[model samples]
Target: METPTAPGPDVPRRSLISGSAAMAAAGGLVLGAGAATAAAAAMAPNGASGVVQGARNGDERHPFYGEHQAGISTPPQDHLVFTAFDVTATTPVELQLVLAKWSAAMAELTNGRPVGKVQPARANGVPGDTGEAADMGPHGLTLTLGFGPSLFDGRFGLEKFKPAGFDQLPAMAGESLDPAMTGGDLCIQACANDPQVAYHAVRNLARMARTSVRTRWTVLGFGRASAGANQITPRNLLGFKDGTRNIKTEEDFAEHVWVGDEAGQGWMAGGSYLVARKIHMMIETWDEDPINDQQGIFGRTKQAGAPLSGTREHDVPDFHAAAPGGGPVIPADSHIALAAHENNGGTKILRRGYNFTDGLDAVGRLDAGLMFLSFQRDPEQFVALQRKLGSSDRLNEYIRHVGSGVYAVPGGLPAAGNYYGKEFFPG
Candidate 1:
């Protein structure tokens, strides 16, 4: 299928309001109390919208437009409702329209407003907004979009526009993938502090794209954030502090996360590659293990999240250090030992994974684990780490990698235009 090429100027390039401005405008409209109100005010400038702005609060309300996408590095939200879609549009124009609509809806949703203004009298037709999140604040919602390698097929004449590193991932060892959960033509990762907010974002976008896309697979996840004033680490379902040593800071992000301009596919510059995996944890088996055994597998103290070689969580692991009796303090086969940057040619990826629970399986065993999401400058970084982890990580015995995908996330929407992936469709 093909679309008649329209004149360049005819395509919609911008939404009604830019993402940042929308947030600023909505900031004054007080949502609720506590973090929600503080977050909203922080997003807007003082007196910008006649609302009394507070000192910057928690990591909420990331701008939708920038050099790089927000969700990848923006503090990981507490909940996630990630969905992958198969583009069913027969024409490029139809696909572009879907993106335009998605961008407009996303702008409003991220600003703590309903997709459409409420008008009871004119609401005779299909509801313009789903209304699930009508009263809830934005909750630091971030909607990140990406294109899978399948999107570059001949369907939209995008074969030649495929980014260099945007290839389907090669199969790794120990993968028992379910076909339904494996791949998709495109993906959107909706993350928010509140689960309902996240779900609402994805649901509305999928609804809007009903004509141009079909849902391939979706995963809902929640995370347990650390308690206390300085909440730095979040625990996974495995009861281990995940992403403790993850790449943070602007310098690290530039070095390890954002794709460089010279890295082939100009459209992908400032963007990053996402590697998603659905790992099923063998809960019954893991639960039977002793505390020491569990700690040994992860190479970290369960209570303090400290490396086996050190007493503090932030202390750099001395991989070469020996225990009192002998042997390495951090076990050779432990998850951290093999997956660490030191072991992988100094490579690192930004982890934004979330713990998930999906009730029980047919056998009545608890079906819960992680939706592993990692972003890197290159897909090779994740591929290399996974290859090592699959072979020797001790935690492998208790986890099974059942679903996977790789996507090339393009740079953020330009300040003037709210459209996404517009560069891929340039005439």
Candidate 2:
């Protein structure tokens, strides 16, 4: 994949990296790259200094710094380790320090290097970097940070920095939200081809910030449930192709996914809002249903994944096509009919969800589900469609909404010495 360039000239590079990492540079926690005149080398980690080069398998890597954060619009990876964190610091500076440390560590990790100075094996001294992913190439790993709604609840003096439309999602129908898994002050989304690579990124990050933050909840997912640019659609636990109409083209991203200056907060201009839902599927029950009923639930053929009115997967659904007898060909309550952008005022969301399975739930039936994740310019795009799904979608009978979160993902760092969310804490 080509390295994504910096955002259009409207967003200044300095403004993107002016805060936490710069603060660390002043205090000596970080090293300086070349002077301003040095040409940009291969992209560094989001907040770390200097170009990171190394040997690897296929050198499958994604640049950490770009116009928008990696892992959002980037093609979906094979595995995911999504984690939310709660800040325990009492002051803004304390929280800033935590973000700074994480930023520097991310730079190294994404560049296929270890965090901090790598030291030789010592008999008594502990190592500064965790050695789990030592030899692993970048593995196409991407770590994207997000600030949850709680982070702006008058904490860290960030209330004024919250986007105008940003807020916790309201309780929609069919939701039995678990308090422990619902809200968080921050979140980090790690996606990579290797499960270990994704896990190592989160494990090391949590270890580094243990003093200032605690993991609120985590989910490990495999077999991406959605497709991105040039990717083929993958199936969800429900045995149906998911995200068949996801936002893909640059035009679609600008229209539906990436946030623009209308965000009412300049810092969030290139950033997007994220919504995650833990949807537990009743696999046993779903498997018992007749194939025709299953097809009706999703409005797509089980084997071919084509719309009810079409013969192929990508064929536009003829929502208005008449059935042989009298009714509409596609049921109004089917998942696709209700969630389709055409039916919802042309609204679209970029989906990067994954299929997940835990051992089992309370009763002994398999505990597996879709970790429903989507990014949009505004959260309401999801809310409006979900409200429709939550209330009337036929598929609701086979799933339960147990956990949820909404976060404001800031724009990407422009270069080294820039931490995520730097624009939020301007001097």
Candidate 3:
């Protein structure tokens, strides 16, 4: 995959990093190439990370940051433990069979081993990634299987592929490998503790993945999955402002976000990621209000990340920090105040997520909302803090939680090579 190299034209700076990486993890967008520049600075600030660093550019006239990522919305509503599979004779098949055996042997719990109740699914037959029938390739088959919640943690007893540290655990079971020599193709995620539910969901996926591998249909590797509940990403709901507060600090940011140094290793550094989220937006209510009201809800102009009372879209808000005792300029309890944390001295995050509209309903209605997603090293400080800040803010009502999940986005495994502990876990 060719890495996107085109830098979007620079735009003026805004008060906060819009949909940043942390926002993405929270279900939000990806960062564009080079969004920061001098020309875009109509009125610069003392410390500007990047223009539209966290933005929602879907609105044409940029209610804020006029030219910054104007009118571009992030792709929304798709998330799975994305990986590319290379089909071959040696690949493992009968994962369901394995599940049946494991289930019979172990408890009904789901974990690394398969659950007992799984069925075979065909890659060439499945509707989602079935692809063009006429375009079969010769090198090796490519199969992409997106495991649902059931397989990993949807179920109660089964929590295979969930996130946790296993001391000295071999990477693989039959032919095990160590982390030093292996980047797992099997991505593990932590769902919201309903292991039983995750079991059923992923069990179905195992059958399909196993069958495809058996049939020499595909070799698996990570692909840029649309961020959702099961994948990790770098963007959010509104398009422009994503991944702004992501720590560029040498140790953590590089270790977590950057491709190789620590997170993935040298071989597969900078490789693509699997992003996922369940962004619950109250469209029924959010869109019902007039445009200005909508703007008020988000604290910035609806289409841009600007203060409700400010001009020049990206101009910094006068948070009434030094306002006269008479009035509230930006509204102390507004979404912007909660979002910007300006009163508390602006805190930010890295956001990468998507915008999706559940199919229109009877009244020509849509579940249009943001599948906000993001990733970062410390979820506590950045992500958790923001949630706490916005807890009682005005925007909470419309956006409520319907689903939530987390995944351990692993680094890549080298192709055609033995993994670490190959000696320990003999294949």
Candidates' lDDT values, in order?
0.74, 0.77, 0.31
Model 3 — which ten-residue stretch has the worst lDDT? 59-68
On the 0 to 100 scale, the lDDT of residue 130 in model 3 is 22
Clashes by residue pair, model 2 = 45-107
Best by TM-score: 2
| Models ranked on TM-score | 2, 1, 3
Q: What TM-scores do the predictions have?
A: 0.85, 0.87, 0.42
Residues 1-427, candidate 3: write the lDDT tens digits: 2111221222221111111212323432222212111111222211111232222221111011111111112222123222222222121212222222211111111111122212225454323212221111111111112222223332322243333331122121112112232222233321212223233333333333343232211111112223322223333333223322233344543444433434322322332233233444556666467766655555566445456567544477776644355555666667556555445444433344445455665677554555434443323323443455445566666664432333333332221122211111112
Q: Write the per-residue lDDT of candidate 1 for residues 276-328, one digit (tens) a residue.
A: 89999998899899999999999999989999999999899989999889999
lDDT of 2 by residue, 1-427 (tens): 3332222221122222233234433553322222111212222334323232222352467777777888898888889999999998676655766675576567657766665323534566455456788777667788989999899989788888877768899999978899888979999999988888889889888876675689999989987999987778999998898878888899999988898999788768788998999888989999999999999888899999999999999999999999999887888899999999889999889989999988887888898899999999999999999999999999999999988999998887777666665555543
State candidate 2's TM-score: 0.87
- Most accurate candidate by lDDT: 2
Decide which is better by lDDT, 1 or 2: 2
The runs of at least 3 residues in candidate 3 whose Cα sits more than 4 Å from the true structure, single-residue gaps closed, are 1-129, 133-252, 255-276, 313-328, 341-348, 360-365, 381-383, 414-427
The alpha-carbon deviation from the true structure for residue 202 of candidate 2, after best TM-score superposition, in angstroms, is 0.6
Indicate the residue-level lDDT of 172 in model 3. Answer: 17
